[model samples]
Target: MCVWILIGLCIITKVHGYSDGDFPQSCDSLLPEHRRSGVNILPQNTKPPYKVTYKPGNNGEPITVSLESNPGHKFSGFMLEARETQRVDEGPPVGRFISLQPDTRLLTCSLSADSAVSNRYSAGKTLIRVNWTAEGAELDITFRATFVESYAKFWERVDRKVTIQTTTPPPTTQPSTAEPSTAKPSTANPSTVKPSTAKPSTAELSTTNSSPVTTSISSSTTQNTQRPDALGLKREGTVQMSLDILFVGVKMELPNIITITITNSLFSRGLIKVSNILCSLLSMAVEISAPILFCANDSCTVTLIALMCVVIVINFMDLVIVSLPIGPSHELKDICDLAAKVCSVIHMVFTIAALFVAVLEIDDCRNNRKDFWLLKVMTAFTVWICLFLIWTFVVSIHRNEILGRNKTGSSKWREQGKKNKLSAAEVIVTAVSVILIMGTLSFTVTVIAGIFLAKQTCA
Candidate 1:
């Protein structure tokens, strides 16, 4: 136990500690001083996986600068700096960080103290905000950051421009100078106030009831001047949303995609729904449909049997048709191999147990015993557990397939996953998956609803 504790401590320290002490050593170039072996990595040429946003700030006041990464995209280290927009390329870091978030620290990238900000440790981060004080005439500046996902993956020069909102002293609320009520009669004759030389415009010249035309024209002008062209705004919003989705897909780290996909597919939805359905759906029968047997319902036994049967068939087909030769246990030769072995054995046990329960369930429903409730509960949980393992098994196979590629870069995977057309097998499997999920969900809901209505009474 002591040894294990020590090892755990070591891992935490290694992962969270900042070995390269905070300094402006590489502030000029913003390149991480990493090992020469270098993993052949380069700055991402694609849409950045990060976003930099800031509310407008008055000069001399601290602006809350926020750096946020998209869902599932996290970084381990980062350096943030601001530069005068006009001299962005040549200028030193401009703003001073007055305050900072935890896990971040100020750096003297320029001669000034706290001229830049950076991560204090190497731990993963999804979002960070810092209070940077904008000073001087260079209120219009650009923010740039270098995000390090890992030693091998980082993007430098992620940039955003902001013009600090400054208060112009409210335009010096001027005193209104009242004009004389009567203009001293101009020192000229009354005849001198002749008709103006300027000719009337075409509409003004038409004195014969032109008010309607003037009103219509003025209304149209007003409509055009007002904000929010509905169609234009909608179109812009839709395009931005589309691009955001596309960029999100393209920016995913390839190394994490398999694990993230498997986890989300299995637990995020499947596990939650499966457990909830099984635990609650059976109660309907107990409350109403059971006629006394929420525990006695035959659906649990039947569903369990069907699920186990499907799993068994899937295992057999995978071995014979999909994996072939030595089966998936040897074919994939990764975590999938272990999953193949474990899932098959667990499902086999479940099938036998389910069949055994089904017999007792039928007999009990006929004779009406308290043990019937126990049997129903057992069946529900068993089926749920089996589904969990089944999803794991499914995900492992898919994960192995995705990770088995001989590729090196994330870009290649993004291009392939995005631009590639679906194959016939892929299309078919996708359709089957959709159908299966819908059918099972519907089945769960129906079982729950069944409890609401008592068994049909004989007329």
Candidate 2:
């Protein structure tokens, strides 16, 4: 009895002792039978960044993975790493990884059996963390090997996945007339389609134009890609005339019209100035790349990467300055910082555009297969821009709230409470900035990989 009890205790301890290292670390380490799988990790708190659904190979069916944002938090996007498990004695390693941000919550990925993804190793234990700076809230979900497989199957049965389908109505057929036609229709095919005689939708005819616009929206859609021209340029004169009439009528409201015109002029001028600054900065990046432009193909590639790093540094500085806590009475400093933040955002946008151009201008890239490194950088930048937009909103909201509350002349304790909340908001901003910097650094590494590849070719 004593021996049996000791053995039972040993078994229990072994079962509970499984650690992160025990899990498959790469796609290659995953069981051959379990290829194309997902492991769901439930969030520790509410508002998880994303919910994952892994559908392991279903009888001979392709493996599938689905992701959705949890309630109270929207899914922004994700970066996935798929590494090939290295043998203990292997000389070197190679693998594939990709980042994607599908807008929909019900994003699905189908992994084919023949795809190389099956050969890549799993990312070992994974974590999904979501931070909502506005609400000063965060949630973390960790996936462990011991529970992933079981949880995935469990969620499959509990969560029903639904797909939406849209159907277009069938075209109406004209009824055959009993009376004989006076003249038979031409046998030759018409070069152009006859315009529909039906009146346009009220929405389509309601477009306005007198506001310094380039074109009038005279159709239901702004543009129809399915059409031959793809611009929806075949608008009827009647529709155009209706829009003109409405726009002219608006202009007749003299005071409102004058105010709108002034606003438009100011906005347009501000946009022009911003654009000019961005263009100049981009030109400077190109000039920096010029010294090594012709030394070697590899040198040119390096130059492009260096330019990207410079922009990243500039943006990082801007982020740091913007993140500095504003004193309670520092309104001027706050306004200036806000303006600087806007300019920094525009600078980053132009910088990203410049990097794209630099990549495209690469001689090797033109002929060689597209590099995943560049794609990763692009994805990172796209995600950063989205986050920046949200961060701006959060900052604006917190600033307004704090200022509004301070105006109320609250008690000392209440003021302190507001200050605490403001501090939390600042912490969130700093955290987001750090995240952006980390992402940018990762992207830089990816760019370096391409540069190294170019160097290899030159060798």
Instruction: Estimate every model's Cα lDDT from 0 to 1.
Output: 0.48, 0.33
Task: Encode model 1's per-residue lDDT on 291-395: one tens digit a residue.
Answer: 212123212323433544554453443243213233223546454445434544443444335433333323221223343343454356347435534654564
Poorly placed runs, candidate 1 (over 4 Å)? 1-20, 36-40, 165-169, 172-459
Candidate 2 matches the true fold with a TM-score of: 0.28
Number of the top candidate by lDDT?
1
Cα lDDT, model 1, residue 175: 13
| lDDT (C-alpha) at residue 345 in model 2 | 54
Superposed by TM-score, candidate 2 places the C-alpha of residue 94 at a distance from the truth, in angstroms, of: 36
Candidate 2 lDDT tens digits, 189-246: 3432222212122213333212212232222122222221211121111122122212
lDDT of 2: 0.33
